[model samples]
Target chain A: MSIAWYLAVSGIVFSLGAFGVMTRRNPLVVLLCLELMLNGANLALIAFSRMWGNGDGQILALVVMTVAACEVCIGLGMIVAIYRRRLPINVDELRELQG
Target chain B: MSTVLFFLAASGVISGAVGVVVLRNPFYSVLALVAHLVSLAVLFLLLRAEFVAAVQVVVYAGAVMVLYVFVVAYVGGESDSVGERLRGAGGTGSSGSSLRLGGAILAGALLVELLIALLGTGLEAIGGYGAPYSPGPQSFGTPAYIGKLLLTRFLLAFEMASFLLLIAAVGGVVLARRRGGLGEEDERDLLTPLDLMRPRETGTMAEGVGGRTP
Candidate 1:
């Protein structure tokens, strides 16, 4: 119930997401990790909102949710298109934009 | 009771998040992500952000996760090869060990930074950090309260969000669409040169030429 506990949990989850993003070879898995990171931030926002006895944090969390949805849609659309063009979905092999 | 629920949900969130990152299969990772989102929604409810919690469940867990599942299925299930490659490359070699070591160091550094920022600062550095926990007004996080705020203080933002979502929907449809000239002979003939150049390419070109020729 304490703010510190929530913040600690958020930090751990965010770090895990970062690690996954760094290590995962699959772009889809990377996107999933990004969602984990976003959820971590949302958790912190709501916890702070509760700590402050206000609704602003929750409202911002809602906005973050919307942004996340948009990101996932565009991300998955790109992934699908790429998958269609290439049989395998490997982030390492997606070096065509390395210029 | 609330504290107990928070602890339970927090554990669920953390464990599911770990599963998402640690799972080799994208399908299982998606499942873990769903669990993580749902537990986070529960945590939101415990924090009294009921409306946000509902939105989290409905939008994130229900809709967004379904989209992810569809994509995972569409991309051919169980990309075990990718996982195998990652592990093979990231293990049993000096460079791989160094990379793992670097990742661990980076993660540890982040953990320390967050702990220092959250615990050492005593909450005042973060605006509204010291606000007394009063649960404010009877309708604090109810749908009515959020709706009022959305329509009044944040009306423009709400409208912009909707507009953004509309654009995203159209963009997704456009990006997900298959090429329109797939059935056209002219387009096929045009692509024949490229297909001839790379006959072994494993993609739409190969499929198109193979289907047409055979």
Candidate 2:
């Protein structure tokens, strides 16, 4: 449809993701929220690419996807480590060193 | 009709995204996130970004989320008191919440501004960018353009991404294998708490006095 509608949807999704990361204590949830934010950006980029008749934005979206994949790879590792250290994967309990 | 379809798809995406945020259980959040990804893919399709939409489904909803699900199940149950712990942790106090909300607003505003600026300039004429590119929606949406562009122009970045993934894989394995490896626990030790839930067979049926006394 219209580009404005896509942007608006992206904005709402990104805001929800931001709120999730801010409020949720679980690292896994935080990662999921981060994915939402990235996906929101991806949507906006594709919409812009379509409107502007350029492939640049689409290419950038591809780069973002690659980055997102890498992020998940590492984030999942961290989650597993957190689970190991505390026997429970809670972000609040993850603090091992705090001065 | 296209506009209506786009709106419906966008709303579906937004709802799933909100579910990802509002759900308490991480497992459900991941599932909702997958739903969100699928809806976004549909939005991409509506925008005529067929290649992008296909990649979105296969890469995100197919591969990435499966990794998430496995990780979540492997992590298993977490402490239900995590919220209380965070409240006491002194990290994301009330101020943090406000700042995060503000950050979200700021991001949204910036995105709006960008879109507005781009829109004011209006859509640039197609096939006018130096050379006449492929014609038709399908031609533009083919992976060939993307493939050549990424390989010839963005080759270095692609290599770097490969390196990053390599590191991530190694790190995940190392991190998962480190301390509390679960190797020391025997069947009996692991079953300590779970074993308590099982009901044992009674030696005599008559002991319960259901039919007759022994």
Which pairs clash in model 2? none
DockQ-derived CAPRI band for the predicted complex in model 1: medium
Task: Give per-residue CA lDDT, model 1, range A1-99, as digits (tens).
Answer: 567777888888988888888777788999999988888888888878877777788888998899999999999998888877764677766778522
Worst 10 residues of 1 chain B by lDDT: B125-134
TM-score list, all predictions: 0.82, 0.73
What DockQ would you assign to candidate 1? 0.50
TM-score, cand. 1 vs. native = 0.82
Every candidate's DockQ is 0.50, 0.36
Question: Top model by lDDT, which number?
Answer: 1
Q: Candidate 1, after superposition: displacement of residue B115 in Å?
A: 1.7
In the range B53-115, model 1's lDDT, one tens digit per residue, is 899889789999999999989897566554556667776456655776788788889878977
Error of 1 at B178 (Å): 1.0
